[model samples]
Target: MTTPESALPMVVPATDLPARVRIHEVGARDGLQNEKTAVPTSVKAEFVHRLADAGLTTIEATSFVHPKWVPQLADAEDLFPQLADLRGIALPVLVPNQRGLDRALALGARRVAVFASATESFAKANLNRSLDESLAVFDPVVRQAKDADVHVRGYVSMCFGDPWEGAVPFHQVVRVCKALRDMGCDELSLGDTIGVATPGHVLELLSLLNEEGVPTNVIGVHFHDTYGQALANTYAALEHGVTTVDASAGGLGGCPYAKSATGNLATEDLVWMLQGLGIETGVDLGKLTATSVWMAEQLGRPSPSRTVRALSHQE
Candidate 1:
């Protein structure tokens, strides 16, 4: 009768932390998209539903990129409508272009995201366009989504480091962020795509963004665990008054376009930290870990989340 919360961290309240944090759950879309093989559309739908049941309010459901570009999430058309009954939870889908946006909007997707990069190399590699060109591409997509009364989230990748071009400049990251904000994105999610961010670097970039007119309320942080700094960076963000975080359940996925990127910060692990800090996340840690455990079983592999393994007692 062991429960996941049996080993929970002692909640020591942090005066600087936000009263509540919104976790933008990405396991269903960003996580599963990296899978070598696509799970069935039914499985994908269930994963999203299970995540909601676990108290994840913002679940990234799927991507609307063309099948040729992302075969795993090609089921965006078949999968989104299945979650029609999931009221009260936000289901965001990645819409890579105007066409992708069309597909998402047609299926009644109210929340959509567009991916951009801060480095030219990552832009060329991931989007096959220069940084400026990539921004131009998203211009119409973001415009149209906003026009349709849809919520648009702009994801700025490689904010900290780029494998092709090491250690990005703070101003360069801020420029792309400004462009997204100017282009009418409702909010921005800064990505530590390569997981090379430290707390100082995270804090500095955040300060620059704030200086450049991006309000703390409209900014979210997405970090990878490659260097094991995701949690520390997240704490830096929380200390900066940022409340939105991007994490995946069971630490299931990485950036499919960036080979150097690793799994995202695990929701359970982040929840553990937030819970320990006595910061409210509204996530049921036990139910969330159990859901990840169930998903790991379906994937035929152990979850990479340390918290999940510890709670489930897996080696």
Candidate 2:
């Protein structure tokens, strides 16, 4: 490959002090959403506690969406009350609409996430609304969350490619991200929901955001391992100043759009990378690995993490 000097940045002094990045552990929600057998709420709570114990400051406990949409997390209401007494863990739950938000607020949720799709088709399939309409639906939710002093996180799915609409434009992504930020979302996770993103694409998208003056600190990346490039893309995002990355422990998530993806970037794999780069994730890799292994056993499957595989027989 002929290297274009302009395509890649010139080598600069590497920062020995690793950038402080927050890893929002999504293994409990995204990881369990697609499974046929619903994981018990006790198991879910245990996983959340384990993740919290591993020094993950933020953990997505579950989704408050309708059980019809995601049967696996139907116990969100049941789970929340049990976890309500626990303190020191920032448990953010996914709320798909006002009803979901209401359910969460009733359980005293302090932080909630509303997800929107960048592509119209995905929005329609996922939320039964057009992109614009979906964005509108979340406006009031964001307002209410803000008024109640609850942090709101917005997710823009399919930032890379869509099953119905291929090759999402960078402009569309920027527009969606801007809209979410404007709606008072404290943070926005630019999701490669169906994956299909490359390092170059990630850098290009971040450059656009930087150009638009969107605060990079409030931006996060959620990548699926569709083409086996999620970690590489994540490193590219790190280099471009993205400090928050979403990963599932044990690589336990797959896209609803099955043909386009498998599991997400494994948390263990991501932590290993961050550790290697001298970044402070605050997550204990050994604990994460052990928890992931236990979770995989409960789910009756092998962990998708390569690091887990290499370390398994050693124990």
Candidate 3:
């Protein structure tokens, strides 16, 4: 059987490189949100500190979504206060709507991410609104965030493929991204929510984004590992001048829409690759893996990260 890496297109180093590539650790928020068991607030705070210690400049602290929607993150108010105690850390929270943003702002969140989808089905299922309607709903939130001087990131989900609607149109993804940009979003993250993207598709869409005059610096990639293609996809995006990438520790995330799919790219695996390529992630691979393993033990299950598995066995 051919592996995912085998199927990936050959990587050609880009002639021009960006000043730096920033990897935002979303393990504490996105990673843990989908977990079956609720991780304790202390564990979540410690995990955030650990990720910061491992040299992650930006860490998604938590979401302010309703506890009824995500009981796992019921301690958002408590969690937000803890971020104040940790210095030199840029923490962003996931805000689903104006209410969510209000909660985050009240808690002193400096940055917020609003999520929308390129596919209609995903938008409806994920947020109970149509794609266009969701964008319309986000209009006020974006305006308010800008007025509040809070940095806002717009997440375009199913940019590659949607479980409900396979092979999302590139034009659709571009349309949403452009709308978000026009709405004053500081950055946009093209998300592979189901991990079904290939290197060819990524290059094609990236080329489209470039043609549309979307600045590469403000664009990021959030790839899932459902088909084990996250790393290859990351390398492809990096070659295309994508400067920011979102990943989770221990491969700990999943889409509620895609039942059989895996989570985001593992931070441990991503850092390992970057380090091997002489890239500076400023993250300690060993310590990162140790933190992942500890979380795995707490969850009473082994992490899905390949790097963590390999490194943990040596201990």
Candidate 4:
């Protein structure tokens, strides 16, 4: 006997969800690198260690960019070596240029990420180059990293919206994504740098990328929570077959280049939703939230993550 449609239970479509989602924790590098005060190298190492202890397999450790640009991460050389012995964790460092790649390679980095902007305004503001010019600069860096047998992740920022240029076109984002993939990037992460994307926009962009032959499996989503749409956008991406999602512990960092940008989607928050949805993330929420609370105390501020705050209050 068929029940009436109204009597059917409301359940999330199983076919629309992934069995396992990989949460790429970026709090160490993307989170702390934007802070005004410098974090001690020891504390940074401890933070990474704690995240690993919480079963976060992929933790972005640090960036090897020029000290003049991101002085907060000037201790990358000292930091990378300390994390070398961490078992079962993939530590990816951000390399802005060939020089940065050389520094990372010298320290035995196994994975590195290169960034590119999807809009001309962001390119000029962040990299001091035009859109095409920035991609040109990252070309050799990606190639060299590939030659060194180091995995490379390509990040395209300002994918949905830009502070200087409003409402970026979908084609512009796809072009950059294809360029990154063609340059040997093992995976491409689309960044909503200013955090203005909605779920509708995310679905449209991912759909367009799929139509253009970009494999959704090799694509990741990086969202900021400025507009409170990060989680919604992430859900949309996951529905579209994107399995990798970038998040920060405690919602730690924002883009310095994009002033209006806010903290990233918190890893704890993401985990909470994923766990409720029956998705396997291999993370311990208790330990992850505790780590965020500890880091927040070190920073002398409360965490922006709602899950962390609620869990901390309960404790």
Write out the backbone clash pairs for model 4: none
Best by lDDT: 1
**lDDT by residue for model 1 (206-286), tens:** 998988899999999999999999999999999999999999999989987789889999999999999999988888888
Q: By lDDT, is 1 or 4 better? A: 1
Model 2 TM:
0.93
lDDT of 3 by residue, 96-136 (tens): 89899999998888899999999999999888899999999
Please list the C-alpha lDDT of all candidates, in the order they appear.
0.93, 0.85, 0.86, 0.92
| lDDT at residue 191 of model 1 (Cα atoms) | 97
- For model 3, the stretches where C-alpha displacement exceeds 4 angstroms are 1-19
**Model 1 segments beyond 4 Å from truth?**
1-5
Give the winner by lDDT: 1 or 3: 1
| Clash totals in order | 0, 0, 0, 0
CA lDDT for candidate 1:
0.93
Alpha-carbon shift of residue 98 in model 4 (angstroms): 0.3
User: How would the candidate models be sorted by TM-score, starting from the highest?
Assistant: 1, 4, 3, 2
Each model's Cα RMSD: 1.1, 6.6, 5.0, 5.8
Error of 4 at 120 (Å): 0.6
**CA RMSD (A), model 1:** 1.1
- For model 4, the local distance difference test gives 0.92
Q: Write the per-residue lDDT of candidate 2 for residues 1-315, one digit (tens) a residue.
A: 122334222334349433678998888888889898889999998888888877788889899989988999999988987776568888899999989999999889999999888898888888999999999999999998899999999998989999888999989888988998898999999898887999999999888987987888888999998888999999898887788999999888875644567888899888877776778788887778788888888988789898666556323
